[model samples]
Target: MILVTLLSFFISLSYETIIFCSFSITITIFSLSFISKYPSTYLVDYTCCKPPNTLRSPSHSFLKHSRLNLSSNLESVDFQMKVLARSGLGEETYLPPAICELPPTPSYEASRKEAELVIFSSLDSLFNKTGLNPLDVDILVVNCSVFSPAPSLTSMILRKYNMRENVKSFNLSGMGCSAGLISVNLAHDLLKTHANSNAIIVTTEIITLFYYTGKDRSMLLPNCLFRMGGASVFLSNKKSFRKQSKYLLLHVVRTHIGSCDEAYNCIHEREDSEGKIGISLSKKLTSIAGQALTANIHAFALQILPTTELLFFLKTLIVKKVFKQKNTKPYIPDFKRAFEHFCLHAGGRGVINEMQKELGLSWEDMEPSRMTLHRFGNTSSSSLWYELSYLEAKGRMKKGDRVWQIALGSGFKCNSAVWKCNMDIKTSSDGPWFDCIDRYPIHVS
Candidate 1:
């Protein structure tokens, strides 16, 4: 009987050990799950560089500069002046120093100087705003479509700032205006893969190389539209930034129609009759850009639209595609239902007008874009940030507000990034639009 009692006690001890082991194993798995999960990305802040007022090129000054470049060709001069008057750019827009000079000095040294002027100025402001250490940045992306010289823009930033030895750097050239959001999309994916990190995207177009002396009316449009500006944006997946960050990145949608023959050929860089290199815009650009916008927004709507809108969209699709209903109009979703604000790329007045008509947005919805283009001509890839800055300067951004940023460029590409405001945001005193924000919503007619 004593031996039997001892044997039963040993069995009870073995059962308690088994239960303890099972509980410990379960706790280990729960902790590991948190470690393996992807961290959310945030836009801590951004800075847009406004060159000194001395560089300001009002309409008369811009016209005078153009005449010299077209000095020998009277007809071309007449054509450009007409384009400029209707270009929707206001009197206060700026031009780079090199382009403003007579016998314009668009040399290798001049281009680098332009890069240093814009890039460093923007980075200086960005670092001061966020108090982020330069050495802490783990990833860097810089883009300049026209000017990519030796010791690339990325290397210049690295050497100047002394980034970490293992910093992942990417330099994008020839990607055109859409490259800004493209870089955003790229940085977003990288943040997901590399946990607890910081990234910076610097986007701008070098105006020095953009001027075309040859008389291609197509190429001359670029000369009239583009101006000098750059933007530096900060993004991070660091958990500590969650409380202070301005925007939480929600979604990014990119559409490239470059595979189609007409879309691919609509915009190209080539030499004119005088062997002068420039980017030419096709007359078909307006319609082709419309096509790209439609394709991009359709995909974006599917992900962000509410269930009711989604159902309605699918019903329209079935009626149009499956039933072959010839008379049914294509259903356009009410984007305002999903977003509180819009930062459409201010490509030009024409491009902004096209977006307004296509998206069924009101004039108030189009203010930020129109004002950005007027105040600062097409800054290429960096244009979207200036528009965002306009909204903040006006104190329009509030906690929980959602902003949809749409960017289009020469690759026949349209890319969109959706950002949800993490906190109520007001522009600091240093933004490009800070002084002029109250004066905007100007009569662009």
Candidate 2:
């Protein structure tokens, strides 16, 4: 009787073990299936503007014109010109003819003309390269920080391309330079809801209308840094395009510190004591940007960093927080291990230098950004794309490589976008950097 009872107990244990194994297998299959069906977005192609010949104005010429046009004191004009010379922007950077003329007053008509030229040229080239009709685009996103007309930039694109009547359109204004990636994040969310959709994002800033001609030294910074540029990017979630796409959208992380008064006012548009309206970049902008970037990178690393990196970061956090180790510096993750290419925003030379030091990036990692700034100046939201194009031009981009694009904007916003290369990209003739790429990776100081 004892032997029979022991045998029955062993059989019951064997039956329970088989059931647990079957359940585990079922869950594993379901998880795999869910991952396989997860939605993905692709960047099929992109184009950055090579500003028209009529718009090109060398730095010395621009400074001389500004000195003559502004009624400010001679000392102020000379100081501003000196700032421009040391701003690390090369002579090739283009500006709208209206701004280069340094009109006593900003011209709305000239600003509109600049927009039409930049937007039309960029969109035309993008459509021609993608071979995808504009009408086929289901969503349109246009971002211009300082320029938002009554008809809206998105509406202008619609009319120019004669897109579908039911197409969804969005215009992001006053979001500052980081709005480009903001638009991309918005499009990614929209694509998830609507399958088999195509979205085009146009990023540009109109420096002509926003040109500050006043004597305010802070206001004059934009004049020195901004130049004519625009970029058009095509994104699609259609599985069919995956094979031909250039990059796969991996993640977009954004952090805005506008709630802090100092941050909100770090870069602001206001009328000065003379009632001259202009964007005033605060003296504390670099510090505010660094803080914003710290917050953004911390949040972003949580999502994409490797397990070992995260573990080390957590250990450091524990030592600082739990052990009350006040002297410990926060661990900076080695982003180089994760990203093969870096597109730090070409906001200015100072901005790039601060970022390089903070992130511990080598000069080679910053080459595209420095070159883009030297070649194109600060193109606002479009600068990131120009940097990416530089990497493609040099044949540095390869399949499976990961690219990181980071931008800081006036809202005291820091934003990051990560992309995995989908295929080997060849330098295309339509790219803004294609012709002069061989000359780039040049010394810029």
Candidate 3:
């Protein structure tokens, strides 16, 4: 009887143990399934506006109609012409029709037309490529540094396309060139909360209102650099769009030092002595931009750098802190190891030159930015996309390649976006650079 009872008890305990183990696995799998469903942002496709050749103005013609031409100050005209020549801008860069014409007609209507022309062309191209319905966009973000009309850029887009009533929209102004990545970051955050969704970010600068007629040499600098261009990008979190997407967004880092009085005032848009409104860039801008870029990239490096690179950086930090090696500079990890391509914002020739020197980038690494600046001039927030498109047009983008886009803007901000190519992207004669890409990598003397 004792043997029988003991055997029965042992059998019952064995059954219970099996049941508990099975239940544990069931609960764990359910938790894993929930976690696995979380969404990720993808760059579906994008298109950039190439203003018609009719708008393209050669350097000499532009100088003739230049506001500085009105000054009749031979020295001032000479100064602008010299700056334009060395500006890394080719003769083919475009200007708004209004600005290209004599006695420039910069009114609300003209500005609206320019916006419509740029935004519509880009959106139409993106829609054609992706076949994405306008109403299907869950969120819309438009960043134009100097232009935000009463209806708002987002509102204007909605009116034109007749999007859904519940679509989330954001219009960003005064955010400067870095605003493109700011838009990307915002869309990424909203995508996290909204579950599966589609987003469109349009980056552009309107020159009509920003055209400085003032004679401040600092103000006239913009006239010699900025041109007419824009880009529209599509982002999605839905699983269905993954197959067609171009890149998977890995990270976005932004560094804003606007709190410093000098940084804040470095690029101020105010009235000149004659009360002509324009943005005056401080001579201190280069150093400030350098500081912001260092802060931005340092943060991003921690996330993207290889384990070995991180260990080396950490070792340097320890040496500096524990051994008091005040003379030893911390390691600047090789960014080339972290990314296959770098799209430094075509902010300016000087900015690119400084980056090439500081980061130790080769001419080829700096080519996209230099070529974009030469072909498109500075398109404000949209310049990074043009550089990226330049790479795509050059047939340089390939499957699994990593890309870095770094931009600096008026807020005294530096922002970086990292992406991994999703699939084997076939090289094609498509995008803004298709017709002119072969002519690029030109000697920018």
Candidate 4:
């Protein structure tokens, strides 16, 4: 009888244990199912506007125009022009009509015209490509660092599209070129909360108004660097649109070094001694950018890098910190292993060169950025899209490939976005590079 009772007790305990295990498994499966049902944000399509032919300003034309406008010594102007030509910008980049003309004073009307032309053209193309009615857009984000007018950019977009009455809209000003990715992150968060929502993000900078006629060499740099361009992107978290999406956002990392005094004032907008207003880029910009990028990448690696690469990086950190190895350099995990394509910002030749050296990137890895700079100059926040478009125009993007977009800007900020190609992207006839794709990868001195 005692043996029988013990056997019965064991059987009851085993049965209860089996019931609990089954319940846990069911809960796990249900949780996973619920998680899978949540919507995922996707990039439906993007378009970069090509400035009109009237706006095209080759290097020689720009140099001649600058000499005619500025009161600086001919020698100084010539030196600045030479620096600009060697700044990795090609001969074909376009500037606003006002800039090409080098008006005696900055023209607000000309600035407005340039902004309207680029923004409208880009949005028109985007809407046409995606067949997305503007009325369906639930959120609108517009970023232009230097040009925020009385009728805000977002308000202008809303009026142009005649969007729905309650559409959420925002205009980000003084955020610098990195504001493009910041807009993307904003849209992502909004989509998560709104569910099945669509957002439009427009990035551009108005060069006409920001153009400096002043002789301050530092202020005059913008006169040489910035050109006319803009980009518009459509994002959606609707599951029904997944089949038509081009890419899925994997991660976004942003780092700002504004707390540091030097970084905060590195790229500043102020009036020169002559009371001529312009943005001054400090000589230490490249170093500040490198530091910001390093911090941003360290954060990014933790999220996207493979375990083996992470382990190696951790080992290097341990060796440097614990062992006090003075000569050892911190390991830059093989980012090439994590990403198949790279779209480093076409900020300038020096910026791109610095990034290449720091990341140990191959020439092929830097081609898109180099080509974009050569073709478009620095379009500010829109520059990254132009680089991405170059990759597509060259037929380099493949389904499932990963692409990384990095941008650095004023406020000493570094922003990065990682995307996985969800579908094969074909070159569009109306793309920014469509006419000049064949001539690209051209040697630029």
> How many clashes show up per model?
0, 0, 0, 0
Q: Report lDDT (CA) for all predictions.
A: 0.86, 0.85, 0.85, 0.85
lDDT of 4 by residue, 1-445 (tens): 8865744453344445645654675566557645643468899999999987777878778767777875457876886787786898877889877676644345888778888899999999999988999989999999999999988988888888899989999899998889999999999889889988999999998878877776788887877778889999999999887888989987889998899998999899999998988999888888888888987877887677764565567556666665578688888889887899999988888888889988889888999989998889989999999999998998888899999999998998999999999988887687999998999798766
Among these predictions, the greatest lDDT belongs to: 1
lDDT of 3 by residue, 181-246 (tens): 999999999998897899999999988888877678998888888999999999999988787899
lDDT of 4 at 97: 71
Span of 10 residues, lowest total lDDT, candidate 1: 6-15
Better of 2 and 4 by TM-score: 2
RMSD of each: 13.0, 8.7, 11.4, 9.4
Better candidate number, 1 or 3, judged by lDDT? 1
Candidate 3 local accuracy as lDDT? 0.85
lDDT of 2 by residue, 1-445 (tens): 8865744443344445645654675566557645644479999999998986666778668767676757557877787778778888888889886766644346888888889989999999999988999889999999999988989889988998899999999999999989899999999999989989999999999888788767888998888898899999999999899899999998899999999999999899999998988999988888888898988977887667664555556556666765588899888878887789999989888889888987889999999989998999999999999999998988889999999999999888999999999888886765788678879778876
Residue 419, model 1: lDDT of 96
List ranges where model 4 is wrong by over 4 Å: 1-38, 102-105, 321-324
Root mean square deviation (Cα) for candidate 2: 8.7
Candidate 3, position 406, lDDT? 90
Model 2 misplaced stretches (Cα beyond 4 Å): 1-38, 102-105
Task: Name model 1 segments beyond 4 Å from true.
Answer: 1-37
